[model samples]
Target: MEQKSVWLDEIKFKAKPSLKEDINCDILIIGGGIAGISTALELKDEDGVVLIDKGKIGYGVTSHTTGKLTYLQGSIYDDIEKAHNFKTASRYLESQLYAIKMALDNIKKYGIKCDLEKNNSYLFAAYDVDKLDKMKKFLKKTKIKYEECDLPVNIPNINAIKVNDTFVFHPLKYITSLREIIIKSKVQIYENTRATSISFEKDYYKVTTLEGNIKAKKIIICTHYPFFVIPGLMPLRLSLEKSYALLSPYKNEKFNAINVDDEVYSVRFYKDNIIVGGFSHPLYKNINYKKEEDKLIYFYKKYFNKDIEMAWQTHDLTSHDYLPMIGRLNKNHPNLLIATAFNKWGMTNGILAGKILADLALNKQNKYADLFRLDRPISFTKVTNFITNNFMVGKTYIGTKLIKNKDFYKNVHIEMIDGKCSGIYNDENGEKHIVSNTCPHLKCSLIFNKLDKTWDCPCHGSRFDIDGNLLEGPSVFDIKLK
Candidate 1:
């Protein structure tokens, strides 16, 4: 079985050159995932616009998505109403619908063949029927057409709500097609170009990258989690969760379903494979990643009784208010825009963020800008959640620092090498790989991910390979021992 995202199979695109010299542009985007690529597509016709990624485009969080395009998210409207108000919930729903339309429009206009298929989206609940009822009421009030039905696939559920006019597509195909268009346009793209720091000049911002520096009149940060905290305090405003996914060969099903239970299970299909995703928890809370993966494997075996073909995992950022932050970082930094915290529904939110961010960058007014502005009014729920999330982060940070050499695997252990704390992993070939055990982002202790053979940060979500090369990050530096 492959330890990678199912969407990454067979799709290939040419790699773009990384920035090799100091460069200047009118706008510089600092990520290449859906949010970044979508933003670049919006500004493709604009002059002097550039996009750069630490890795290849469409290979980050976007590749790991389930790729469902529907406004019938699992109890999102109800959750939003509880957090804010009905108006906010309704507006959020509208934004999602509009984002879906935007995606459809782009697919049609570009003739992008991404295996787009129309399907019914189902939201089921095992014990939280009240939550499902509230969502149904919201859909009714908003004049959306839905029907009470059983899940199309055989899974444990008490009640379900189904909505038509929704769709799913291959996420990587859609993204790579967009990349092709942007490449042929005026927008410049750079892969393997990591942005390390940003300094504010009098009239512009300068972004320091690995091999070069970028000076731009405007900047947009679409990185999953902004590496820095000053302008937005992203670490305090966001909490992250990691989820496991596996695919099995099965008959194609035209419907996708997600349960509203505490341990959510989402199911969809691609061609002849059944994709199951669930087993979500607060990121880095439990370091036993292999056990977590085993739970997913057991679920697939129990339900579908099929052999797993591909298995992988992904991390998602959630906001205190359960809304995406997609506007100016702060009033003082109007030229600096950001889009983050998709709340596990990045396919739609990322597309909408692109529109909102593009509009803001061009000095145009987007209708939904006020709804998701970074500096919007904080509610009682947001304040409480903010405290709760940051408290856990603080606890994890301190707790990881205090613990030393707690072995979770036989092949991996922490030890002092040359008077420095280091992580040692014994490969199957009986070779030892060693690196610093400290996360460069916030100095949190690194936990070995046994399933993937990597070091993962428990406080933030920064990840590194066994050799201590940074894989994903809020950290811009590698953890290799000097």
Candidate 2:
């Protein structure tokens, strides 16, 4: 009934628009969430940069995130080290640390009132008590310095392994601050701008929107889930992870002094508000949003004795190696770069990505650029990823061919080639247009989620408007006709 910005509801502003005529820019950044805004803000003073958003800025996945900027991604270091030796894992860790620093510096420089706070982050144990041991061993192998602690939080049936320090801030406030700077820098911020098509000709990237077009020396596919499928091959490598959270009823109402890493759950407090999050599931074809919400409710009822206030659900782009795919979209599309699949760890990652992508766009050098490059090899241990990720994507292909017969209404969810996800709508027009059927994220085939009129993705859990435009990510593109 009531809609407001998640953590920072006080923010108010109007969504901007794309230029209606041909304009040249040094770089074109798509998707105006934290990532796009960060890039545009970083390069705003620099020439030839324009940022566009499918909707309003800060309304994408960045808004729904439990913003905890930290290096501790609870119970991930062990797998990271195991998947690709300690050395490479250390690189990933260091890269994340570098991102954290970038955000800190910008916050200070801009004097952003994003409620920036420093605290110790935690990854506690619920089931496997030895999870911390693997992290310890991995840290030792990498020769990284970290301190452990007994967590002081009051909760039932929990054990804690402390990460030295972590940070939290109001992400929307940070993005809003960047938006102000970008506006002042003369980088156009276009809200409600949907990029319809993109082409590369004569080494100039041309992005066509419903209203106009833009020509740029380079293009960035930061629209959460990329619009075009060719560059990132996002359909194949990334799967959708839908998660839920609740913000309400302060207990000690203590904010996360340090980021807390829990796969099933994450805890943080914003002033008097406590945010409890977790309930990650594959957002595949026929994925149940209600089931996802029920899980969050179960966790809430079990843990806290308070009324739940604001609740939100969102999806993340999870990659094969659990890192992220940044840098060029593909070799053939050299001038195009992509930033997606952040594993729901977007704030710092996105900040670092702005720097790395900005440098690459400028053809300058960035050391970690190699770490997140698009063409990085998928290692042997990650072969399992290929199968699991592909399995999810297969549903899209199958969903596309459900049935064409008009009477095929029993299982009527189908992805039309015209990019429409249609139901049997007897419109006032007295006929059917067979509206946009493609999942907004990665153009996956959407199966009719009987429980919800929402079409569900088998690859990533991007929902859509009945017309097939984006309702969620990793896709920011809505399914609409040309």
- Candidates in order have lDDT scores of 0.89, 0.72
TM-score to true structure, per model: 0.98, 0.86
Q: Supply candidate 2's per-residue lDDT for 443.
A: 52
Residue-level lDDT of model 2, residues 79-116, one tens digit each, is 66666767778898889888898888888888888988
lDDT of 2: 0.72
Per-residue C-alpha lDDT of model 1 across residues 99-214, encoded as one tens digit per residue: 99999999999999999999989999978888888888888999999888888777788899888889999999999999999999999999999999999999999999998999
How many pairs collide in each candidate, listed in order? 0, 22
Q: For residue 206, what is the lDDT in candidate 2?
A: 87
TM-score of 1: 0.98
